[model samples]
Target: MRMYISPRAPKEVLDYAQAEANDSGRHANHAEGSCFPLSWNLPPGADLGEYEWVLNGFDTKDLPSINLVPVRRDEPWETIDAHLNRFGAEYLLGIMPTLWQLEVRFHAALRRSGIPVMMVPPINLASVPSLFAQFPIHTVLTPLRYLPELRTLLPSRDPHYMTILGPSDAPIECSPGGKVSQEVHLVPGMVALFQCETLAARPTTGFHPSDRFIWEWENDRLYVTDPAARFTRLMLPRHYTMREETCDCGRTLTLTEAV
Candidate 1:
């Protein structure tokens, strides 16, 4: 059968996957790398019915062990909440579909309720009461776009827990007292690596290449312009933005509320 690879797929993504696949003993949740960083497309001109593409580098032979907890689609909140409570997930990681939805659906209520409010991180996963009882979750990580929003939206006048950028193990420095200063700094090596090694690994997918990964920066502070940045297979650019700042508690990155 004929096969074609996506031209957008970065060489480093393939290299990273190959390295992980070859050395299966590495932890699956590495801070510096990701398991699935890009969306590789089948080459054009191949007979759709006659050709098939087999993705390499995902052979889970030596990857870390993880629980694939399945939840019922009909009543996911009930099902997942029970599981998390049973398993004791103190720190929960979640995905926000978009900043607009986050603001429209829950931000106001959340703010009114105050910081440290019991929540399931991604609001859809569980009811507020269930989250408080099942997990010790204090921090909710959103997409890179939401980073600026979170800095402004969440009642984080003080340095709370941790702020992880992209898939790296390094955490960004946040100010104390929750009043996030607009000042920022940038890291050259990480940014270059992300552009060449990570973001380079995927096609624009279904979106226009120009609109593929939305980003913005002012005074070296980063901002996520598009909300879709949360749900894409692209590399998270939070660190890329963080690496360009001077780390001053001065100016803030401009945030445009999604319409």
Candidate 2:
């Protein structure tokens, strides 16, 4: 029988599995919190029993509306051309760690062939113009951590392609060039923030939250605070500043590790 193990699986089951795995030296490989980035947890010939551990979705219904699908390997260029032409895509958005090794090279080749390429970092947006000998992207959307690197890469002109900084669900501020803002807003309620803080699901077993953190940014430093709630052990960078701020969006709480 196939058993689905969500992050919300029974404590006993999770504990038992963890204990057994620890004793057996069979812990999941590349495991990130409740999820595994890859499926290489088991040995070459080991069986994982009938139980299927699903860290995210049970199936397609739980996935996002944005399609981040793989391209046909035999004719990837043709595939990209077809998709962009058919869908009328302005410029292709390339999320890194592509499905195939050749995907990145093909994308670079396409850029050389004069197609626009908007790469999400740590693919290095700084090298876009230098590598491709073309104009910089119209806009760059990156996590706050990468803003420092971006500052060194901004073109001389003011408002040289907008830069969006923040987490996925948070309300990102668009800077004209490379000026980092002091504070940013969340979408009021979103799963990305809850997941980041390792906030558990409500009684109904849903990950949605009515509360979220407002991030304060400065000098390439990030501090997040959500006073109404406390954080779990899984949050990154550990202890926080715990400052408070009043805003039209919502209450602001600060979190970050000691410098």
Candidate 3:
């Protein structure tokens, strides 16, 4: 079995994984060293398809784990409220297909401290202002297509937006006008176990590439290579123009603009 360490993981954890890989005669890749390998080949009879991605935090089995309460679209609001109140939910993470259709009462039913984290697709941009006024949504995860409208609609709420390529993938961009960041997972999967993150204060339209992965631009296309990940040289679908100069915010991380 191949194990990749998260960039945020403690030094001891990374060292242990490296030591184990070395002892087992498997090649180990780390962010501190040279660029990752470009090969995408797998060993004969080795199948990674059966392995499910899991995030293993520092805690052991004895510690209390996170409880995720799933709510169906057609489920009664009373039942949802009961579950939230029973679990003493601190936040609401919802996937809404239509933002305008969501009742304001649903948000009002939550406790005062229960911030909402909403994930929505490209919806009618006109409803954005009213939605924000009615719901105290702390964070929004949406597709790239809606960013231009969101930027205009929520200029003051710059730090609350994240751009996602798909439901399973990690966010491509986070907090547009505030601190821009992205996570590079060690293994390419819906859930990330080992990953590294890149952060910059007040980035323009792009982010700096983390040392955990190597990034290349080919004809306006962005391709990333994660040494510890199973997939090699994944290309981003978006076309971007690169800028090497310092940003107005004084951050020196290389910036890119979606073109």
Candidate 4:
């Protein structure tokens, strides 16, 4: 399994790891390198001083295993037009009839390299209750409420992962939607805390990209803008995507699936 620490330094990280390896060490909830430090994509955190299409490296106090892949904002209309003029075949095959080709480009690249991409969902820890309670379809990610760590799911099945950005010790579980017996409610803290290698899956049946796999959120610490306004004023489709794909409830990612 590939463990990704964060944007921290090597020596500092080593010290943390050494401590975690000790019997009397208090670093037990999660491993030192399992946590991947992430960077913000919205403005403020992302400087508007320059319009360059460049990416930044995430800065973590702990050393990260691999450099994170840069992501893009919503698929602007121009992005979609460019794709239609080029890979029209693949473009048409996409769920949304006029989605930006860049949406699927990340998945396509990762698929070719035989690696599942991880996407961090943008959500505030304080308002998490709203997310799971009124979770939207397609857009509402299927967090393996089984994992005990900080990771959460988003709309796209594009191997993209998101972090609701916050620390929580509360136990959370899933409650299936259906009849009395058909519908199931889950317990707290039952989800697996960490899965070292979840980004390994299949050749992907198709592409599923999104503007906000994470509900376009608020909270400067976790999301880009004010989520309350985004959700309330926006007339977006919950899943947002115009298509769907099959998934394994237990299996984490299709591209990073264990063969």
The TM-scores of all predictions, comma-separated, are 0.22, 0.29, 0.34, 0.19
The lowest-lDDT stretch of 10 consecutive residues in candidate 4 is 178-187
Candidate 1 accuracy as lDDT: 0.29
Model 3: what TM-score? 0.34
Q: Candidate 3: where are CA atoms >4 Å away? A: 1-136, 144-159, 166-204, 245-251
Model 4: CA > 4 A from native: 1-55, 60-123, 137-147, 150-259
Winner on lDDT (1 vs 2):
2
lDDT, residue 60, model 4: 35
Per-residue accuracy of model 1 over 4-48 as CA lDDT, tens digit each: 122344555444444543576422222233333333343456445
The per-prediction tally of clashing pairs is: 22, 5, 3, 34
**Model 3, poorest ten-residue lDDT window?**
187-196
Tens digits of per-residue lDDT for model 2, 47-97: 445222222211233234222322122222332343345335344434332
lDDT of 3 by residue, 126-191 (tens): 666666676655544443345566778777764333332321233444443343233222221111
Winner on TM-score between 1 and 3 is 3
Best by TM-score: 3
